[model samples]
Target: MAPLEPTQPDCVWRNVAGAGKAECKIWQFPTRVSRCTDATNVTGFTWALTQTWQPPEGQVYKLNFDAAIFANLLASVVGVIIRNDRGQVMAALSLKGGVVQDSDEAEVVACWKALEFAIDAGFSDLIVEGDNATVMKSIASGQTDLSRLGNIYDDIHCLARGLRYMEFNSICRSANGVAHSLARYAKHLDEDIVWLEDSPPPALEALLAVSRLRLNEELEFTEL
Candidate 1:
């Protein structure tokens, strides 16, 4: 009998004076639907804590390398920890390599620097480790690099060839905590620094932590 008032913002009222009533119609808008897929779901894969820093065998040395990039400053730095089979920190290096285009390039630089360090130190048998699996795999394949990091990769390959034996392996970032921390520390440095038979105080805790791990491991074996 009476015209109904529009109760919603999107509804409009139509005059129906002849019928003695007003009609209100509301338009329905389409709602956006979002589909989110978990990375594990899409690839049918999951990550596990399977990696840890392990000392090399016998006289061989293990070098864990990592790189940190500062997008704001357009610079990158690399950190390397050289440890003997006993897990003793023989030497450490942190280098500020000016600038790099991406994290991949930064990692390449780190690997290259590690190789150079090994060469200078007269290390013949060494194992190079990094958190970047792709870079490690590429280097291990010994393939040509026609990409942006070709020069860096070529240098790495050249240095590696001088070694009696050099093995490149990738580990999870969690396993490379010491090198990762050192890389971050290098971000504020003006130049590269190298320590022999010692590590900077900032990395002392991590070194000690690894030493403790080694001790525990030795004790376990002795008990066995």
Candidate 2:
């Protein structure tokens, strides 16, 4: 048999024509070095970590809320869930919010609706929670909101004043999971829905584990 010849520029086929004529060449690859900045540059900056939902102390009730916007549907949806110090659902709302400009607007609408829901439920001592940090910060700081969302902000502020004790806070998305799910579910609804002392089955299932843990904590406290 004949020795093989090189087929492609980078590859070689040996023993094609004859043993002595066989051409076998080794290929060398260049070493590649990537220079990265000092580890301190990346590790130096730190951000405050977010926390999950916790039942409010005393007789306060927490309203965890979120919104979802569907551009194709030209609509927005809001979810508001009120839970007591025991972390059990007291009331929940799913509203088919009208058309909104953007996510900020959607969240603002959700915030307003949350206050409305709380007030309608006769909840005076309440903590309003959402995942939009900017909106929450604006409300918490009592900054003079001037954006389009300012209208909703004003409504929420006025309504909040009616409560004896109220606070606006932002939680991480992990803590707002149930509200997120409910808002996403509302995207399919054409009309608003409200449940008193009840929540959507799906959201209830999602909150079950958390509620159980809270219940265990309460039992421990009782024993103490």
Candidate 3:
């Protein structure tokens, strides 16, 4: 079969309540895979939603962060999880904060908080991943941001200087489910929560789900 194409344009404009028009991009990925056998065997295919969390490089730690906006409550929640190269959880945090203007602000705040959490935990070399493309791009740009959230970006850049090594990565939401789940789980919390060498109950299921999907993908690739 031929490869799939995007159903929408690369960029679209949408009107926001107080922000006027905003530019956004939609990303699409294949949800199925097909494997064809040789003439001696019957052809078959299988379909499943696959997502995986990549491990960090040698001696480096991976930090995944996400934010959940609670518009009704006029607040936002941030979740951060750190893991070593062996995929062992080193630390995790779920924090609740004041209202954010939009998802973009909330995402930036989450990234800032995640960096702070990692620094406080004595992690010097790190790979930070988040599902917000815009926020990630801004952080990775290594240039001054003149936008409203420039201060936060400045703080993040300042924080990065203290680290021996740091990288910013943007991943799809499916791959960031653990942090997403933890952020959502913070809806019932009144203060910041932190766990060392462990994860909260809400994130355990998501962590396991991601592990299974990754294993299945590896097995399929090996078979192919």
Candidate 4:
């Protein structure tokens, strides 16, 4: 947690594909950004593998995050997206989770943040959604039955048995507003995390940080 004064990225991005071999590095914090939140909340993982053509049985995991990010004070950013089967967007996650305990660890931290975006977009067939319906019925009732969030729902069903064709559903928070606006723009970053192979980057339009809540509607991070 000492070096990160230039362009940051030294802390995440670990995509490992097996058998046929495929690897991406940057596992330690060094590429950039890491002022250290004083060290504590740590759990970063990314996965994805392929021998040829995997991820296809209904694949679609997109759990949205954003408890309104302080509603007026700003902070809760927890976005997760995984779209497979050629529809593209195989993986995306923007974390900032902070609105105090995040509604009981916000679906066990958005189901281990969609299993670190399905272990880095190995995507073999998954269908997950959120806007929090009890963390999509606690990952479609596979029985993470609480007992202290059963290891984040058993590490999201063991990452859906290392993917090939996974399925978990419960989408409706208005079909998850673009991963809840990138988890309220990842609460203005403290460790700078971004993984865009496609869109939403222009500092997200000066961090719009949405909202409308009378009951539900959130987005945060304001400084611009």
Candidate 5:
């Protein structure tokens, strides 16, 4: 047989009958993932959604979340801060209840408040983001075997049903850093919600400064 001639790129050769090398660039951009969730996945969706974000130039979004996240009833706080197309805070929700729990009531109440706020703002469409992936799945699936969460899930659906358009999805913890801060801030407070448009707490500020220093050190190390 004769040798094959070159075709496109400056590479060695193209794969005609055989497979090609597998190399793909991976990026951590957030997007929507639908679900028809069962009972067990209810809480995970709620926590998972906190780490997600969508690009600007989209419709208004309402993220219902808890600051004190309870996976197996542990004391892990979670929060969500959602921004709209205008970059204003569309919703900032945090929660901390007894025994470090995933309080369906907390999620429901927060969802209600956000829904009310969105309605008042006259947003026609919305995307509900959450930290708990399981909760998100349950919401999308339209049912759950969990009694307590089931009730709140119904409430969430009811609220969402009233919306002109809406979506639900999940994200990772690093992606939901802002919301995590807000949730921690909310959980440790003595009284009602605290709104911050300008600054974060002093501890977070210090932590950020330290992080910047570490990054600088890393850059210097790499240069060497």
Candidate 6:
């Protein structure tokens, strides 16, 4: 009987023998290890927190909208970005909206503004997307909302009727990055800003990032 020894740098072997029978077992440690020195370092290695925005099919337009609440300023900002099947920006809006009590209300108001903007810009076929799942669900439900934000919902539905085609979709915050950027940028503005067939400076980077991601995905798919 001898003491067990490590056969490899990260593994140890054990043996037992009795009555001419022998058995051996080995335990191995993880081949690789990682340590987070701080919160910033830990977050740097985190998986992507968002998904890439997808283009609409056929002639439909994809509209991504988001809201940023400024409680201290007693106001909220709504951002909307519309793109065509080829991911070309058809329109974008960063509007300063009225005060809302919470994020949910703000989101509803953003949706309303987004639809209104789209209709005004003469977009008929739309696939509206937002990161707020509850708001998106309520809008897609097609039921008369009796909640406090019901009036806003009514306005949204009314505007939706003006469109030849309309859809409400919920996406992750990362997927709606362009709109989110616009909403935040609205905080520095005194009035609403609209861009037709282009995006504002603040949203340009995010829009390009999404475009690049879309291009990469397409290339990968093509390669496959």
Best by TM-score: 3
Error of 5 at 143 (Å): 3.3
What tens digits encode model 5's per-residue C-alpha lDDT throughout 23-78? 11112222232223222332222222222343345554544344455455444444
Better of 2 and 5 by lDDT: 2
Which stretches of candidate 4 lie above 4 Å from their native place? 1-80, 83-100, 112-150, 153-155, 165-224
Task: Using TM-score as the measure, name the better of candidate 1 and candidate 5.
Answer: 1
Q: Which sections of candidate 1 miss by over 4 Å?
A: 1-48, 214-224
Per-candidate clashes, comma-separated: 0, 8, 0, 21, 24, 0
Pairs that collide in candidate 1 are: none
The reply for model 6, stretches above 4 Å from the true place, is 1-50
Report the lDDT tens digits of candidate 4 across residue range 1-224.
Answer: 44332221222211122111111222223333122221223332221111111223343433233334456644456766554444345456677754445564665665566566665655454445444445545554555465666787777666665665444433335445666666666666675365645545632432232223211221333322
Instruction: Report lDDT (CA) for all predictions.
Output: 0.67, 0.67, 0.73, 0.46, 0.45, 0.71
Candidate 2 residue lDDT tens string, 1-224: 33322211111111111221112222122112112222233211111123346877788888899998876778889888898887778988887888888888889888888888888888877767777766665665454678877877777767766677765654557678788878888877878888888767758766876676657867999999
In angstroms, the error of model 3 at 218 is 2.3
Q: Residue 12, candidate 5: how far off, in angstroms? A: 43
The ten-residue window of minimal lDDT in model 3 covers: 8-17
Tell me how candidate 4 scores on lDDT. 0.46
- Which of the two candidates, 3 or 5, achieves a greater TM-score against the reference? 3
Segments in model 3 whose C-alpha atoms lie over 4 Å from true places: 1-51
Candidate 3 versus truth, CA RMSD in Å, comes to 10.8
TM-score of each: 0.73, 0.71, 0.78, 0.29, 0.51, 0.75
